[model samples]
Target: MRLRSRLRGEFPRGWCHSAQWWITGIRDLTLNTTAAVATVVFVGEAKRALRHRDEPRTLARLSGTFEGYVASLLVNSGGLAVLVTMAIEEGLPVVLTALLAGWYLPNIAISATVFVVVARSRTRQPAAWAELDFVDQHAPKYGRPPETIEEYRAQQLRE
Candidate 1:
């Protein structure tokens, strides 16, 4: 049995051409789409780390650094992809391919630089994880665990 069924239908011929163009255009932006997705993932992880500071600061710091590296790579790659696409669409011929190569090479260099810089940077002074306490205090109904290990142990003993 086929894992998926292919649908067959007769549609306007113009629609096929339009669809092809649309797909090509979308394919052209693949780098940008990948970068954007990476950026979102990095930012989301960073936010999570920031909100749980008291829970192993080392892990939080590592996560934040990783997020920064990802963000930098995404931004640089996306920028390079945009430049290459513009060069191609403008019909730069052989120069277009050269420009694309130029853009990509520089992006690799930039990514390496950013990765090193982010890795060497210190964790935020206030730390994002510290913010968790405030949220826990304000959202009593959210079922936050006891703030301290002692408190947790005491609560467990009581039960």
Candidate 2:
């Protein structure tokens, strides 16, 4: 029968399609896990850096600003992705999906580039107490005041 021959021809293609889906799922899971671990490590390092109370307030402010920016970008990306998916399901033209992806991909790439620059700059920050004092003097204009190690410890104790 013609139907029997068609089914025979399609059986292997169906198995290949399932295999491709499985591989794609595994790749996504691996990438997600790696990203999660990297985020945890970065947070831990930032917290440790914050423990230096004598450091210029600018460093803290910068870190906070960078973190907030990253968070907002992530939220926006997620919301955009959801909206794109909804539009696709609603039978919107494929061109919309292409446009959305084109817009967000560049934004994400730019964010990542900025993050790298910040991380590198953070590493070069002065660790000396005298440097911190200088930072204190200069940072206030940017709303960053100098904090002393003792003051931070005392505040922690009160809590």
Candidate 3:
């Protein structure tokens, strides 16, 4: 009939005290943990994309950017409802910690897929650093046809 009596038997007598202390620590950390993790992942991905933008595989960088954005958006948004449900079933302190961890953890995984694809492409791509320089030479100079694209390809292929 009494909640306290029922909870006492259902859980150990000292569980409430320990859980309360743990929840207090969780509450202190919830928002900070979420923001720090999400920020680190986003910034790291952005940095990688920027640093590798000049890589031969243009499509890889483009797709990585798009995929990371969409995945993080979907996971974080979808996890909001789960967070709310958890808050109701559990408590905010506990649920928020779990929510932050579970939500962004998968985001890292999803982004890794993009990174791996790009990395593999890098490994397979032929070493041709002058590809862009060849394209640059095509710019008309003083009304003269600077060079043909086929000629540029032939040059790089010869190297």
| Candidate with best lDDT | 3
Error of 3 at 133 (Å): 9.2
Model 1 gets an lDDT of 0.45
Q: With candidate 3 superimposed using the best TM-score fit, by how many Å does residue 134's alpha carbon deviate from the native?
A: 7.2
Question: What is the C-alpha lDDT profile of model 1 across 1-159, one tens digit per residue?
Answer: 122211111122353556654664465355345433333434444444445433444433333244445655767677677777867687557776676666555545544543444344333443433443333222212133454554455345434
Overall lDDT per candidate, in order of appearance: 0.45, 0.47, 0.49
lDDT (10s digit) by residue, model 3, range 9-117: 3343455466654574465465334433353444555456656644654534242244345445455656666776777887779756776767655665545544564
Clashing pairs in 2: 53-147
**Which TM-score value belongs to model 1?**
0.26
lDDT of 2: 0.47
Per-model TM-score, in order, reads 0.26, 0.36, 0.30
In candidate 2, what are the lDDT values of residues 1-159, reduced to their tens digit?
267533442343344556654675566555444333233324433444445433444344432345543653585477568867788688667787777666665555544544554555456655543444443333312122224454354344323
Give stretches of model 1 more than 4 Å off.
1-64, 91-107, 110-147, 150-159
lDDT-better candidate, 2 vs 3: 3
Give the least accurate 10-residue stretch of model 3, judged by summed lDDT. 137-146
At residue 19, give the lDDT of candidate 3. Answer: 65
